[model samples]
Structure formats: structure tokens, C-alpha cells
Target: MMQFCYDDLDQWCHHCVHFVFVDEGLIAFSSFVLHLCAIKA
Candidate 1:
């Protein structure tokens, strides 16, 4: 797994949210629908 030190999770999370969803519709919905940043995290 990719280990993020110095509490860099915030930036990584933001970057990930965009990279995964691309700020599109429906992605902001439930994980059962989009599964974005909600994969058992």
C-alpha cells in the first residue's frame, strides 16, 4: 500500500477525489452508486 507520511492525507484525498470522479455528476452520491472515496476508508 502507498504510505502517506506527515499527515498528507488531506492533499492526497483532494487530489484523489478529483482524479477518480473528475467532479462529474452522481459521483457525489452514495458509494453504492459512485464508490468514490468511500471504499471502506
Candidate 2:
């Protein structure tokens, strides 16, 4: 339903520097969601 999120999902997924280092997909997903909230606010 969210084209914005779908489009940016990959970049958002990879943007989490800490998550990248730790290889934590869950953290990256959370980080991506938080980033979207911040951006939309």
C-alpha cells in the first residue's frame, strides 16, 4: 500500500550503519521505520 516505503525500502534497509555492522535485520527495519516517521513529521 505504501509506495513510498516500498520504493525506499532497500536504501532504508541499508542505511542503518549500526545495524549494518551488527547484521541485525530487525534493528535495520526499526531504524527504517523511525526514519520514515522523522521524515514524514
- Best model number under TM-score: 2
Off by over 4 Å in 1: 1-7, 22-41
- lDDT value for candidate 2? 0.54
Considering summed lDDT, which 10 consecutive residues are worst modelled in model 1? 28-37
List, residue by residue over 1-41, the lDDT tens digit for candidate 1: 22441246454444434443554663654233334235536
RMSD of 2: 8.5
Q: At residue 26, what lDDT does model 1 achieve?
A: 35
Best by lDDT: 2
Clashes of 2: 0
Error of 2 at 36 (Å): 0.3
Candidate 1, clashing residue pairs? none
What does candidate 2's lDDT look like per residue over 1-41, in tens digits?
A: 33443466554444543443355656766775668657765
